[model samples]
Target: MEIFNHNANINFLGMRKFSVGIAILLMIASIALIAVKGLNYGLDFTGGVSLVVDFEQPVQIGEVRDALEKGGMEHAIVQSLGGTREVSIRLQPKDDPASGVANGGKVNLDRIAEDVTRTLQAARPDARLKSRDYVGSAVGEELRSDGIIAAIVVVLGIGLYLGIRFEWRFAVAAIATEAHDALVTVGIFALMQREFDLTVLASVLAVIGYSINDKVVVFDRVRELFRLARKAEPEEILNRSINNTLSRTIITALFTAITMAALYFFGGPVVHGFAITMLIGILIGTLSSIFVASPILLWLGVSKQDLMPKTKDNPELARRP
Candidate 1:
């Protein structure tokens, strides 16, 4: 089946110059916001208490906060989970130097949680602690480092794989697209001050993987079109490639957005944030594959003649000289 027949042709090539300007402006703004406001890193990266509590009746967040305060646990973060029946609480560590550390100056989060739980039980008999987790500062630092390493590895792996399968240009294009998606996603998190946590890290990785999949699809098609239209200018060939795969790209993006929207609305608190981030990434990834990444490749002077070695001395006959 011919994918180009739908005329999903957006004439994006015509507006390519303007798209670059817009992307540059956005990138600058994103960088400035990141530097100024910073991300809202959660307890998963910084030491804090996380407790999941179940109650016999529907829970009210205000009442929980009040109860904790009454028990001398003021300034605790409390939010209802799933609905109003399950709730999670995070308590900030005490500022006192010795409150958290035990022997050898290691954080004793379990002890802190134990004390807090006992205090809460005495204040609110209805609150039943279902589960608890604590991340010490040392442990959180390790996890943060590991997450960064994983993201780097993923980007490099994609570059290497695509380079081997296609060409260095294609590989670079794919990795650039991945970085484009990640920076935009991270910029949004920083701008909005969303909690950066383990779940957020997972979503970032997922977005990287998803963005590359879309980019590689477009790059593969571009490579094919380069071969088919050996005489065409790079811009014309890229436009043709994008036009050809435009239908598939839009359909895939729409379907993914629909699924993610459902999860955002009904997937529960456990995954709601992750789903929202993925949804945003999907839209950005699709747009970047078409506008940002492809335009960069064109600007870089990619041509069909580069990928395929010369077979005939009269190859000039097949292309404009």
Candidate 2:
């Protein structure tokens, strides 16, 4: 069950600057890409009409898309749920009263639904409208705001947890890698202009959880080595800690990657985006745990004294002992 029988002497800490530099460059590029290209926010973040249409027979998604295009709904979002004949479509209303609500009357939600039904009628005559819904722009905005707040809360919570469990230096290092993992993942989405939806947001949260767990494992080992090898330098302890956990890390990552690969290829388009983000998150999470977080301790001047806080002896308690 052991891949590395002897303790590894790999100089992981020696290359801290190189790895940290690369991470910084990648993060900078990612921020630039996101600023310029931006993410493709899906209907979840933008107001739109949604229709759950079920066809008489199994129809190819391509045919459904073509019908939408020909019906003057080229900008419509059509997603097939699995390989079945069910497909959901979300599109902005043609005559949106929200644009001039102050001067106009109430929004005709039913009217928009009728128009979508009519548009798809020509191509699939036997199609049945199972459900109809509308998401207002205001509602989408609220959801977006809430998502951002939730993410911030998660990051702050992680920092607090690490600080209490370990030391301030360890806390900062963990947070740095956590931020790096998130930004890099978001950057990939922005670079590809992939539709950023609620599920994708969920994936981001999942990534944070996975990344933190991995970092804690390595950090815990580092702390353990600090106690055991009192004479060992910080650099040597870091290398030993990472190398000792190398086999476990690799094996765990490999198994998880295999599962994610299967989900990405076979999970269908609805969950495809989620799987892709998860895969990216897993890879980045592993890298950051090893390179980004642990190396930061070295830069922060973490010594054996910091790891083991000096215990102050109370005069009264000492007299009793």
The top-ranked prediction according to TM-score is 2
Q: Which regions of candidate 2 deviate over 4 angstroms?
A: 2-6, 54-88, 92-115, 118-124, 309-321
lDDT of 1: 0.78
Error of 2 at 243 (Å): 0.7
The list of candidate 1 runs beyond 4 A from truth reads 1-5, 50-91, 94-134, 309-321
Candidates in order, TM-scores: namely 0.76, 0.82
Clashing pairs for predicted structure model 1, backbone only? none
Q: Write the per-residue lDDT of candidate 2 for residues 68-97, one digit (tens) a residue.
A: 889777767778878578998887656545
User: At residue 162, what lDDT does model 2 achieve?
Assistant: 90
Model 2 gets an lDDT of 0.82
Per-residue alpha-carbon lDDT of candidate 1 for residues 167-261, written as tens digits (9 for 90 to 100): 78777777777877887888899988887788888998999988888878878888787777738688877787788788788888888889989
